[model samples]
Every structure is written in structure tokens, then in C-alpha cells.
Target: MKILLVGAGLSGAVIGRDLAEAGHDITIVDSRPHIGGNCYTERDPETGVLVHVYGPHIFHTDDEEVWDYVNRYQTFRPYKNRVKTTSQGAVYSLPVNLHTINQFYGKTLRPAEAREFLEEQADSSIADPQTFEEQALRFVGPDLYAAFFKGYTEKQWGCSPTELPASILKRLPVRFNYDDNYFFHRFQGMPETGYTEMIAAILDHPAIEVRLDTRFSAEQGAGYDHVFYSGPLDGYFDYRLGRLGYRTLDFERFTDQGDYQGCAVMNYGDRDVPYTRITEHKHFAPWESHEGTVCYREYSRAAGPDDIPYYPIRLVAEKALLADYVALAEETAGVTFVGRLGTYRYLDMDVTIREALDAAAAFRASAAAGDAMPAFVKSPL
Candidate 1:
């Protein structure tokens, strides 16, 4: 079987490698000059620091299979994400932990006392919180929401918290204890070599052929037995119905001597601050020593056609547009949609890899059984 895998990101590379290993010929195409998609990383020419070009992607997953799968490609260095946020005039820990709560209030309260205090702070009026603002008010109350979340949320999403869905805030944790590790996943680490090298290894199989700077069209699916597109769903259809909403990131690059911010990521929670966060690239790979440091001030905005789409702003309007695309995808043959952009969801790295592995396995099983593969291994809608 000849397979046409588009986008050459983790999804495409993983699926292509799996299919190729199964004795199928795989041709992976990517519009970009490099692979790894958003997770692309390279050593800075000047600073010699491993830079995550798009942004800092800390690989954290509870799934042992996904953890083991990535480890096969590259050696992973144990990395824990401890984020810091500056609100008003003071700095605090992230995920609204016990220390953060104490620091914000300028009081040293015990766990039980802090929990009771937050219950008092919480807006009991919002019984059934529907929006992000309502969720924040219900969980952390007005003061913490205003100081920590409100300004930052507005800047990050470019919308009032009331306009966003409650599900967005649900992902974040509000710990009553002092666990400041950003993610609670069992396995948290980063590739010692850059992501590009890891992905290159994944696509290094004998049966797999990679074509860089190649744009794949939907009409070109005739030459292959199956097509797996990991690009934007709207892009695959050329935006016939309408463009889905997405948030694109803009990074202002600057180099400095020694440590810039003394941390990997620092979130500027005040709305007055123009940029959302400043990520020191050197801090990402602390095991490597460098005299000069590279950093990026991140700015988030609505994605234009030419801009690279990062976060899918799956609000009401975008969801409707995505629904139409999902329907169109289902109707299309010899094509399967995979990855974050294909499904139009904000997926973490682990979820993306897990889904790609499943998609590849399903394709192989279906092909062996002489059955038609579904357009989606996991439903977008």
C-alpha cells in the first residue's frame, strides 16, 4: 500500500513510520522546510542553546506507552515545568497553589484554613457556571480571578472571559496544597536532542520517503491507497465553508548574556503588560551550559490566513464551522484527518502522539481485513 501523509508533523511522521514498518510505502509531505511541526526545536547559532522555535513544549504524559514510544527515538531529560506569574506588582507560583494563595493575600494560612478562606472568597452566587469568568469566580473568587486570571485571560484569548467557554478554565488546577509542578503527569521530560532530530529518527525507516517544502492538494489523493492529512481542516478544504477561529503566537526575539529572567516561563498576568509571557530558551534545557541566553516575548492574536495557526479558538462560531468541515471530511473518501489541526482541538503533545499511534494501528488492521478505514479514528465533533 502507498500512503500519502501530509504536514510531516508528529502525527504524519508517527503514522508514516508505523505504516512503513508494516511493509507499506509511505510518502510524507510538509510545506515547511523542516519536520516536527510546532514542536520543532534547534540549537541557536549564536547562543548554542536549544530553542523551541514555536514555544516551550514540555513533554508530560501519564500514558506509559506514549512515554516509552518517544524514549525509543531520543533520550529524554527529566524536566519539571514550574511556572511563575507576575500580577499587580508581585510574583507568584502558577496553578493557584497554596503558596500562591498565601503570597497573593500576604498571609500564611494552613491547608484547611486556606481552603475555608477560598470558599469564603468564592462567589457562591454562581451555582451553574457557564462561561470562563463564571468558572473563575466560582472556583477562586473575585480577587484571585482579577489579579491572576482576568487580565491574563483577556490578553491571551483576546476576548472577555465571559465570552469564552467554562471548559477552558476547567483544565487548569487550583491546588489547596503546595504542589507547584505545572502538570500532574507521571512522566515529564524533554528530548536531550531537539524534537526535529527525534522526529527525523521516527521518519528514518527504509520504506518511508520525506519530501520537504511540498504542498499537498486534496485532488492529489488519487496516487495513493490512503491519505492522512494533519494540516488545518479548513486548509484541506481550502476554506470553502468558512475559516475556523485560531490564535496565532508572535514571538519577539532578543539575546542576552547570562540568565535573562532566571526561569523558563514567566506569565505577565496584568492586562497593562503588552505581552503574555517571556520564555528563556536556555532555561528549557538547563543541563546544557551557555554564556549567552535566548528569549522570546510571546504575543497572542487572531490567526490570519498567512499566519501559522497555534491554538484553535473553538468558540461557538468556530465550532459551527468545524462541524461543517467534519461532515465534509466524513463524506470524502481515501482521506483521514488526524492531529490537533485536523481535529481542530487544542491537544497536548501526548494526546497528539497517542491518537497518531491509534490511527496508524487502525489503518493497518482495517487494511489487513479488507475493510474501509473511517475518515477519523477519533471524532472531531
Candidate 2:
């Protein structure tokens, strides 16, 4: 079977490799002259540091299979994400750990005391939280919420915490003990060589032909046996139904001698600050040493048609728009929408790869049984 994959990101590349290995002729196309999508990385000409072109993407997952699968391409160094946030003119550890609580409140409370203190801090009236603000208040109270989440959330989503759903904040972990690890995933590391090289290796199969700078069109994909789209879900239908809301970022790159923020990522949790966070690229791969460091101050704003959509703003209005796209996708045939943009959801690199693998396997199974492949592996809506 001849398979055409749209968007040569992790999702497209993984699916392309899987299908190619299974004796299917695969052709992968990406509008950008690169693979790996947002996880694209390249060496800085000036500093000799591997910079995350799109943004910093630390490969962390609990799935051993996913880790092993990626390790086949490049060696992954042990790098745990330790994020710092600047709130109210002070730096605090992220995930609201014990150290953060103690420092922020000027208390030397033990683990038990800290947990109990936070419980007291939580708003008792709001038993059932509705919005992001309510969720944060219910968990960490007004002070912590205002300090850490309010400004950052407002800036990142271009909306108030009251407007955003509570589900967005639910993933963020709050610990009693001082465990500053941003993610609780078992496998957490960065690719020793960088993400691009890993993706390049995945597409280095004989049966797979990757065409960067090539954009796959629905009319063009008609000849293929099946189409796996990883581009914007709205783009598939040419935005006939209104465009799904997305938050795109603008990176302001600058160089500094030695270290910049003393960490890889530093969130500016203040309304006054224009940017959401500053990422030091060199710190991501601590294995490498450089005299100078390059960093990007990320500013999040409404995703225009021209801008690269980073995070999908799944507010009430956008959810309705997404529902229309999902319905349109179901009506359309011979196309399977996968990955972040295809599903119009914010997905991590590991989840994207896992979903792509699953999508490919499902496609093969359906094809062999002469059954129709569903419009989505996971629904966008």
C-alpha cells in the first residue's frame, strides 16, 4: 500500500517508519524544510550549543517502549527538568513543592506541616471548582495562585484564569516534599545529539521518502491508498468552519556570557513581564559546555493564520469550532488525522510518538481486514 504522511513531525516520522518497515511505500511531506516539528533542534553557529529551534522539548515519558524506541536513533542523556519561576520579584521552584511553600511564605514547616498549612490555605467554599482560577485556589489558595498561576496563565493563553477550564491546571502536580522535578514520568532525558538527528534517523528507512518543503494537499493525496494528516485539523477543511483558537509564541533570541538564568527554563509569573518564560538552550544539554549561552524569551499570543500554532486554546468557543472540524473529518474519507495539530490538542513529544505508532498499527490492521480507518485515533473535540 502507498501511504502519504502529512507533516514530518514525530507523529508522521514514526508512522512513516512503521508503515515502511511493514512493506508499505511511504512518502512524508512537511511544509517546513525540516522534520521533528516543534521539537526541531540544530547546532548554534556562534555558541556551538544545540538549540531547540521551535522551543525547548525535553524528552520525558514513563513508557519504556517509547524510550527504547527513541534510543535506537540516538543516545539520551539523563536530564531531569528543574524549572524555576519568577513571581513577585522572587524566584521559586515550580510544581509548588515544600521548598517553594516554605520560602514563599517565610516558614520553615516540615512536610506534614506544609501539607496541613496548604489545606488551610485552600478555599473551603469552592468545593467543586469550575475554572482554572478556582482549581488553583482550591488546591493552593489565593496567594500562591496569584503569585504563580494568574499572570502566567493570563499571558500564555491570552485569557483570564476564570475563562480557562480547570482541566488545564489539573496536570500540574503539587508536592509536600521538595521534589522539584517538573515531570513525574519515569523516563526523563534529552537526546545527546538533539531531536532533529533522532527524527532524521527514524526517516532514514529505504521504503520511506521524506520531502521537506513539500506540502501535501487533499487533491494531491488522492492517489495514495491512505492519508495520515498531522497538520492543523482546520487546514484539512481549509478553515470553512471557523479556525480553531491557538496560542502561538514569538521567541526573542539573545546571547549572554557563561550562564543566563542558572536553569534551562524560567517562567516569568508576573503580568508586567511581556513574555511567559525564558529558555536557555545550552542548559538543556548539560553534557556540552559553552563559553556563551543562547536563550529565548517566549511571548505567547493569538495564533494568526501565518503564525505557527503552538498550544491549542480549547476555550468554549474554540471547542465548538473543533466539534465542527471533527464532524467534517468524520464525513471525509481515506484520511486519518493524528498528532497535535491534526487533533487540535497540545500533545507532548512522547504522547505524539505513541499515538502515531498506535495509529499506524490500527491502519495496517484495518487495511488487512478491508475495514475503513477512522477519521481520528483520538478525537480532536
Candidate 3:
């Protein structure tokens, strides 16, 4: 069978490799002249330090299988993500840990006392929170919410917290104890080489041919036995329905001597600050030493047609738009939509890989049994 994959990111690359190993002829196409998608990294010409071109993506997952699978491509170094936030004029540890609570309120309360204190601080009126603002106020109270989350959330989403869903804040941790690990995932590390090398290895199969700077069209997919799409879901249907809302990022890059932020990521929670966060690329690869460091000040804005969509803003209107696309996808034949953009959801690298693997396995099983291919292995909506 000849398979055509759109978007040579992790999802496309993984599925391509899997099908190719099964003796299927695979052709992968990506609009970008790159392999890793947003996870792409390259060495800085000036300092020779590895930089995440799009933004910082720390490979962290609880799935042992995922960790083992990625390790096959490159050696991974142990790296823990420790993030700090600047609110007003002071710096505080992120995820609202014990130190943050103490320093912010000017009190040395213990873990139990702090937890109780926060409960008291929280707005009891918001019993069943629906919006982001209500959730934040209910969880951390007005003062902390105003300082840390209110402005940052506004900048990141380009909307007031009241317009956003409560689920947005659910992922964030508000620990009473001093555990400041950003993610609770079991496996967390950075690839020793870079994400691009790992993706290159995945698409390095003899049966697979990768076409960079090429766009996959419906016309081009006719010759193939099956097509696996990892591009935008709305793009597949030619936007017959309205465009799904997405938050895109604009990165401001600059060179600096010595350390800039002294950390991998620094969040600017103050509303006065234009950008959401600043990422120090050198800190991401602590294994390598460079006198000069490069940093990116990230600004989030509404995604336009030409901009690269980073986060899917699944607000009420966008969800309705996505539903129409899903309906169209269901009616369509001979194609499977997989990955973040294809599914029209914000997916982490690990989840995207896992879903792609699942899709491949399901495809193989269907083919072996002489069954028709599933329209979607997992529902995007």
C-alpha cells in the first residue's frame, strides 16, 4: 500500500516510520523545510548553542513506552523544569508553591496552615466555577489570582479570564508544599542532541520519502491507497466552515552576554509587560556551556491565516466551528486525521506520538482483517 502523510512533524514521522517498516510505501510532506515542527532545534551560528527555533519544548511524559521509543533516536539528559514568575516587581516560584505563598503574603505558614489559609482567601461565592477567572479566584483567591494569573492569562489567551474555560486553570498546580516541578509526569528529560535529530531518525526509513517545502493536496492523495493527515483540520475541508480559533506566538530573539533570566523560562505576570514569557535557550541545554546566551520573548496573539497556530483556543464559537469540520471528516473517506492540528486540539508531544502510534496499529489491524480504515482513531472534538 502507498501511504501519504501530511505534516512531517512527530506525528507524521512516527506513523510514516511505522507503516514503512510494515513494507508500505510512504511519502511524507511538510510545508516547513523542517522535520520537528514546533519542537525544531538548531545550533546558533554566533554562539554555537542549540536553540529551540519556535519555542522551548521540554520532552516530559509519564509513559515509559514513549520515553524508551524516543531514546532509540537520541541520548536524553536528565532535566527538571523549574519555572519562575515575575508579578508587580518581585519574582516568585511558579505553580504557587509554599515559598511563593510565604513570600507573597509575607508570612511563614506551614504546609497545612498555608492550605487552610488559601481556602479562607478564596472566594467562597464561586462554588461551581465555570470561567477561568472564577476558577482562579476559587482556588487561589483574589490577591494571588490578580498578581500571577489574571494578566498572564489575558495575554496568553487574548481574552479576559471570564471568557475562558475553567479547564485551562485545572492543569496548573497550587501546592501547599514546596514541590515546584511544573509537570507531574514520571519521565522528563531533554534529548542530548536535539528534537530534530530524533525526528530525522524516525523518518529515515528506506520505504519512506520525505518531501520538505511541499504541500499535500486532495489531488495528490488520489494515487495513494490511504492518506493520514496531520495538518490543520479546517484546511482539509477548505474552510467551508468558519476557521477554528487558535492562539499563535510571536518570538522576539536577542543575544546577551552571560545568563539573561538565569532560568529556562520566566513568566511576566504583570499586565504592563507586553510579552507572556521569556525563554533562555542555553538553559534548556545545561549540558553545553556558552559565554553568550540567546533568549526569546514570547508574545501570544490571535492566529491569522498565515501565522503558525500554536494553541487551539477551543472557546464556544470555535468548538461549534470544529464540530462542523468533524462532521465533514466523518463523511469523508479514504483518509484519517491524526495529531494536534488534524484533531483540532492542543496536544503535548508525547500525546501526539502516542495517538499516532495507536492510529498506525489500528490501521495495520484493519488492513490485515480486510476491514475498511477508520475515519479517525481518536476524535478531535
Candidate 4:
């Protein structure tokens, strides 16, 4: 089968690689001039530092298979994300750990004492937490939530915490210990060279042909046996049911002579601050020595048609719109939607690769069994 993959990102690259290895010819196309999609990285001309073109993407996962799968293409250096936040004129460790608690209130309380103190600070009145605000108040109390989460959430989501779902806040963990590592995953690492190099290597299979700076159209898609679209779900139909809401990011880039923040990501929890976080690119690959540093100040806003969609705004209204688009996708023949944009969810790099692998396996199985392919191998909702 000659399969057409629309989007040369992780999903398309991984899927194309697996399918091509299974003796099927694959042609992967991207609208952009590059192959890595949003995970693209390039070396800075002046500093020679590898800059994350879109933003910082730290690869971390608990899945052993997913971990091993990535190691095949590029070297995986051990990397753990330790985040910091500046809130209300104070800098503190993120995920609200013991050190953060001790520094914020100016007391050296032990883990047990800090846990008990937070319980006391928590609002016992709220029986059940529904929204982000309610969840924060119930778990960490008003003062901590206001300083650490509220302002940051407001800027990131472009809405009040009350309007956001409790699930969003639930994703973040509040630690009782001094351990300040951001993720709780068993395995965490970044590609030694860069994500683009890893992805490019994946697409280097003999049966695959990569087309950069190519746009996908109905006529173009019809030429192939089947289409695996990793582009936006609404975009497949040209946003006929109205565009699903998304929060895109704008990166304000700057260079410095040496270490700027001394950390990879420094988040600003002050709502008054226009941007959410500052990412120092050199810190991502600290093993390599670099004389200069590249940084990015990230800002979030409602995505326009021309803007690159970063985070999907899957509120109630957006979910309804998504269902309509999903229905349309399901009814459409010879097409399968895959990845974050295709499914409209915030996916980590590992999850995206895992899904792509599974999707490819499903395609091969379907081909072998002479069965029809699914519109979505994984559910969007």
C-alpha cells in the first residue's frame, strides 16, 4: 500500500517508519519547510547553541517500550525537569515542595509538620472540589494557590481558575518532601543531539519519502491508498463546523553571554507578568559546553487561524465542537486522524510516539487481515 501521511511530526514520522518497515511505501508531507514539526531544533548561528525552535520539549515517560523505542534513533541522556517559579516577588521551587513551603512562609518545618500545616490552611468547608480554584483551595489553601497557581493558570489558560476544570490542576502534584523534580515518571531524558535529528533518522527508512514544504489537499490525498493525518482535526474539514479553540504560544527570543536563569524552565507565577515562563536552551543539554546561551520568553493567547496551535482549549463548548468534528472524521472514508492536533489533546512526546507506534501496528494488522482501518486508532475524547 502507498500510504500518505500529512504532517512530518512525531506521529507521522514514527508511523511512517513502522509502516515502511512492514513493506509498505510511505510518503510523509509537511506544510512547514522542516521535518520535525513543533519539536524542531536548530543550532544558533552566533552562539552555536541548539535552540528549541518552537519551545522546550522534555521527553519523559514511565513506559519502558517507549523509552527503548526512542533510544534506537538517538542517544538518550538522563534528564530530569526541575522547575522554578517567581511569584509575588519571591523565587521558589515548583510543584509546591517542602523547600518551596519553607521558603515562602520563612520557616524550616519538617515534612510531617508542613503536611499538617497545609491541612490546617486548606478549606475544610468545600466538601467536593469541582473547578481549578476549588481544588487548589481544598488541597493547598488560598494563600499558596494565589501565589503559585492562580496567576500562572490565568496567564496559561487565558481564563479564571474557576472556569477551568479540576482535572487541569490535578495533573500537578504537591509534594510533602524536599524533592523538587517536576515529573514523577520512572524514565526521563532528552535526545543528545536534538529531537529533529532523532525524528529525521526515523524518517530515513528506504521505503519512505519525505516531502518538506508541501501542503495537503483533497486531490493530493486521493492519490494514495489511505491517509494518516496528524494535522489539526478541524483543519481536515477546513474548519467547516467552526474552529475548535486552542491556546497558541508566542516566543520572544533573546541571547546572553553566559547562564541566564541557571535552569531550563523558570515560570512566572505573577499574573501581572505578560509571559508565563522563560526557557534557557543551553540548560537542556548541559553536558556540552557552550560559551553563550539562548533563551525564550513564552506567552499564551487564543489561537488565530494563522497562528500555530500549542495547547487545545477543550472546555465544554470546545468539546461539543470537537465531537462534531470527530463524527465527521469517523464518517469520512480512507482517512485516519492521529496525534495531539488530530485528537485535540495535550500529549507528551512519549505518548505521541506510543500512539503512533500503535497506530502503525494497527494499520499493518488491518492490511494483513484485509479489514477496514479505523478513523481513530485511539479515541480523541
The 0-to-1 C-alpha lDDT of every candidate, in the order given, reads 0.94, 0.92, 0.92, 0.94
TM-score (C-alpha, index-matched) for candidate 3: 0.99
Expressed as tens digits, the lDDT of each residue in 334-375 for candidate 3 is: 999999999988899899989989999999999999998877
Candidate 4 lowest-lDDT run of ten: 215-224
Give a tens-digit lDDT track for model 2, residues 168-190. Answer: 99999999898999999999999
lDDT of 1 by residue, 250-281 (tens): 99999999998989999999999999999999
- Model 2: which residue pairs collide? none
Q: Once superposed on the true structure, which residue ranges of model 2 sit more than 4 Å away at CA?
A: none
Evaluate residue 139 in candidate 3 and report its C-alpha lDDT on the 0 to 100 scale. Answer: 92
Number of backbone collisions per candidate? 0, 0, 0, 0
Q: What is the lDDT of residue 348 in candidate 4?
A: 94
Task: Check candidate 1 and list the clashing pairs.
Answer: none
- State model 4's lDDT: 0.94
